[model samples]
Target: MRTGRPRQFDRDEAVRQAMHLFWENGYDATSLSQLKAAIGRGITAPSFYAAFGSKEKLYKETVACYLHSHGRVTDALWDDTLPPRQAIETTLLRSARMQCETGHPKGCMVALGVMSANSEEHRHLLAPLDTARARTREGFIRCVKRGVENGELHAGASPDTLGLVFNSFLFGISTLARDGVPLSIIETSVRQIMALWETFSVKNGNELPNG
Candidate 1:
């Protein structure tokens, strides 16, 4: 008698489930068993390996999915048509709202996922996350540079310093969300954060404080 074909599973759905698992629990904390369970539908170890290649590979795919889905809001940062201030504000607001949403994991996958790498191999596995973060920082730098060029910000303002500050604040919002801070509070804080940009405005005629 001919054997039945192996059961088929939805690869996209599996990646989303795995993304939620990784988003809820950091890379080192999530296990193969947990991953299989999260994928469900009786996905066996061999089947899992055949489908995803390996745990690290699966995590990479999951991160990509998370970026494409929940993380796409920040793409406004790269929109040259928007004013620099608007681009930064849009990124901050979108990120804050996304992080605080109740449906998904509380914090940003990029911010919380793979924070601590136990080994060189693990670091390599998490390299994409690092790249994601670097890209955000670079976007901030570009926006700040554009602000200077457009005279929205003072010529003496430092893009590197401003980028670091903005990226750090963005990352901190993820931590606050994970800590159970309310969405309303995060949104309010976003407004306050945007006010800092005003202090850098060329219209305000403010200069960086001397050391």
Candidate 2:
């Protein structure tokens, strides 16, 4: 008889599945068995341990996947050709559409986890979320600096402080979006923030950060 080769697991797909499950149910509510079932591997606990090493590791992979998908949206918003206010507005509008959907899970996994877990493993699992926040702040700071160099932004505002304010607004809106706020209200709230930027007027969308 001829010997056949064994099948291999798709690590990325496995993590994506894990991410959706965790996004829907959170860390504490999801058990190992649930993870195993959700991942759809015929493998046993020993195999899962061998593949992912630990639940914490699996959680990290899940968060990384979520952030990777989300970062693309950030990339489009952070474009140098767009005004700072438009960038921020675009992100919020997109988020409103995604978060308000009836079929998909609620809010961001990072925001939801920040609210739900306290175990050291859970905290460790969430380190990626901290990194995502820091990256978002850094992107805003970069946009502010670019605006300053181009003379589009006001001279008095500090980039560091601007970044903090921007991040705070985003965080609050993200939480509200998770809570199922209407898109009209979300758009109104975003416009209110844009009014403070001063360099860019949301009315005409003419202010370009680079041009």
Cα lDDT of all candidates, in order?
0.85, 0.70
- Candidate 1: list runs displaced more than 4 Å: 1-4, 114-116, 205-208
**Each prediction's TM-score versus the true structure:** 0.91, 0.75
lDDT of 2 by residue, 15-120 (tens): 8778877887888887889888766565578767877998878887877777778535566456867876567667756665666566557666655767546777
lDDT value, candidate 2, whole model: 0.70
Model 1 score (lDDT): 0.85
Clashes by residue pair, model 1: none
**Deviation (Å) of 100 in candidate 1:** 1.2
C-alpha lDDT (0 to 100) for residue 192 of candidate 2: 78
Per residue, candidate 1 scores C-alpha lDDT tens digits across 64-179 of 88888897767988999999889988998899899988777888988885474566768887777888889999999999999989888878889999888888989999889988
Question: Clashes per prediction?
Answer: 0, 0
- After TM-score superposition, the amount by which residue 126's alpha carbon in candidate 2 deviates from its true location, in angstroms, is 2.3
